[model samples]
Target: RVAHMVVEVPRWTNAKMEISLTEPLNPIKQDVKKGALRFVSNVFPHHGYIWNYGALPQTWEDPRHVDPDTGARGDNDPIDVIEIGERVAARGDVIKVKILGTLALIDEGETDWKLLAID
Candidate 1:
């Protein structure tokens, strides 16, 4: 199926930006941790994110709903997408994408699904 991805953190960037879950219109904002702006650290071989990181609008991973495959409640956020297309999308760019597949990631007892897609 086709989906629209709201780009949050662009490719090859260290800033931990995300769609503001609690804000009006859910604008993209940098995530702050411990009162400081957060930056994802490179783990071993990988640098900043290798692909465009974003979420699908109008799609929420309801915390009250459990996924049958992962058997975990949702992370209470919009479904995330990893855009693997050739072009690097900019922050806040809402690009149409074709859903290729999905990865079920259980993070801290919450189901954080990563939807793999192409622009």
Candidate 2:
């Protein structure tokens, strides 16, 4: 059996763009790190324009470059904002993004799929 129990994140989000697991009143918030988007490869396209594994526009719209964080102004993709939202909704545990970060696709072998693919 799986060591940790499984839970599911909701689809809706608050104005903060973060999803709280405790309840609608206590939505847990986290940033959309490069680790979460790493799954863009095995990603199940949400909203529109399926962002290829490494195709998410760097800095939101740098085009040729890949920047998860907009270290600069006007350097973030509106799409990434939504993708992070979906990730939050799909997740089911501790109300954190890293929950999915350490998840496994098969829970076999020496390491997990997330570790193999993202790590």
Best model number under lDDT: 1
Instruction: Give the residue spans of candidate 1 off by over 4 A.
Output: 43-47
lDDT of 1 at 15: 95
lDDT of 1 by residue, 1-119 (tens): 99888999888887999888788987788998789999988765877888899999888999999899999999999999999988788899999999999999999999999999998
Q: Which ten residues in a row have the lowest lDDT in candidate 1?
A: 40-49
As a TM-score, model 2 comes out at 0.17
Task: Give model 1's TM-score versus the native structure.
Answer: 0.90
Per-residue lDDT tens digits of candidate 2, residues 62-117?
33443234322322221122123233333334222221232222222121122111
Clashes of 2: 11
